[model samples]
Target: MKATEVLADAYERIAEVVHDAVEGLSAEELNARIDPKANSITWLVWHLTRVQDDHVAEASGLERVWTAQDWFTRFALPLPAAATGYGHTPRQVGTVLVESGELLLGYFDAVHEQSTGFIRGLTATDLERVVDAGWDPPVTLGVRLVSVLADDLQHAGQAAFVRGALQRR
Candidate 1:
């Protein structure tokens, strides 16, 4: 199979998990942390989406949906406009509020659409191109995408786990 197809499929799986984790959850459930220091479903989904938006945008030279579509304004989060939840402390995680599950899904769907669109156009050569030079072996477009996918999948699963745990409690 082509690299583009593989990339697109990977994104699709992540979206499924993300949707399952957030769909039908009330605002309280989305925002509720399993413990005082744990991340909420809201935080996990938001962080994963933000990371995907930021990384994929950088790799594709496209604008992030967060700023391009003014989702930052919509969220009206207390933190800075650039906050993507990386290194967010427990206190900061508590601040990722949403009124409903739909808001979370809306943002995730926007990001997923943008991301898949970009990936569908990539050639193998494009994936081979270096996107970052700070790392020891540097980072290629392929590596960067895989990294993002791994992170997103892990967080999506965490969100799903949080949802199940919340329901159990």
Candidate 2:
């Protein structure tokens, strides 16, 4: 398989996991926190989607799906347009309130489409191109894509765990 195909598959798995985590969850459940300091399922999913949208857009030199698609306004979140839930405090996490799973899922689906499109268009040479220079080893497109996959998958798993915990309660 092509390298980009592999990456696209990984991203597709994230979308599946996210769907599993949020499916059938009530708005209250999505916003419920197992612990006051822990992130709610809603927050986790939203954060992961935002992070993916931000990183992939940057790597692809395209506008973030969040902004390009007006997801921030659709979400009507309390934060600024650029907020991605990274470094969000417990209080900040609590601010991610959505009325329905569809809202989160809709945004995620849009982002996943955009992410896969960017990945699909990438060439082997494109993957080798540097996207960020802040690190000791400059971050290449491939490295950044892997980083995003790792981060999104971690959050998706966390959301699944939270859903299980909520189910048990």
Candidate 3:
């Protein structure tokens, strides 16, 4: 398989887990935290989606789905317009509650559409281009995309775990 295909597949896995973790869950379940300081399924999915929307948009030189599509307004969270849930504390995490699983899935699916579209068009040379220069060695498009994929997968898995735990509670 091509490198782009592999990347797309990796992201697709995150979407699968995201959907599984949130589908049919009620507001209370989605927003439930195992501990007072723990992350909720809602928060995990939203944060992962936001991070993907932010990073992929930056690397592709495209507008973030969050702002470009007015998702920030839709979410109405008491956070910055560009908030990606990075470094968010427990209180901040609780503020990411959604009315339903569908809202989270809608935003995630929108981001996935944009991310996959941008990624599928990239060549090996495109992947080598520096997307961020702040890092010690500078960050290439490939590295940045991989980083987002890893983060999204981790959060997705966390959401799944939270779901399982909540179900068994």
Tell me the tens digit of each residue's lDDT in model 3 across 1-169: 9888899899889889999999989999999999999999999999999999988987788999999999899899999998889999999998998998888999999999999988889888888999889998999999999999999999999999999999999
lDDT (10s digit) by residue, model 2, range 35-112: 999999999999999999999888887899898888889999989999999899989999999999999999999999
- Per-model C-alpha RMSD: 0.6, 0.7, 0.8
Query: How accurate locally, in lDDT, is each candidate?
Result: 0.94, 0.94, 0.92
Question: Which 10 successive residues of model 1 have the least lDDT summed?
Answer: 74-83
Per-residue lDDT of model 1, residues 21-137, tens digit only: 998889999999989999999999999999999999998999999989998988889988788999999999999999998888999999999999999999999999999999989
Candidate 1: list runs displaced more than 4 Å: none
Q: Estimate each model's TM-score.
A: 0.98, 0.98, 0.98
Models ranked on TM-score:
1, 2, 3
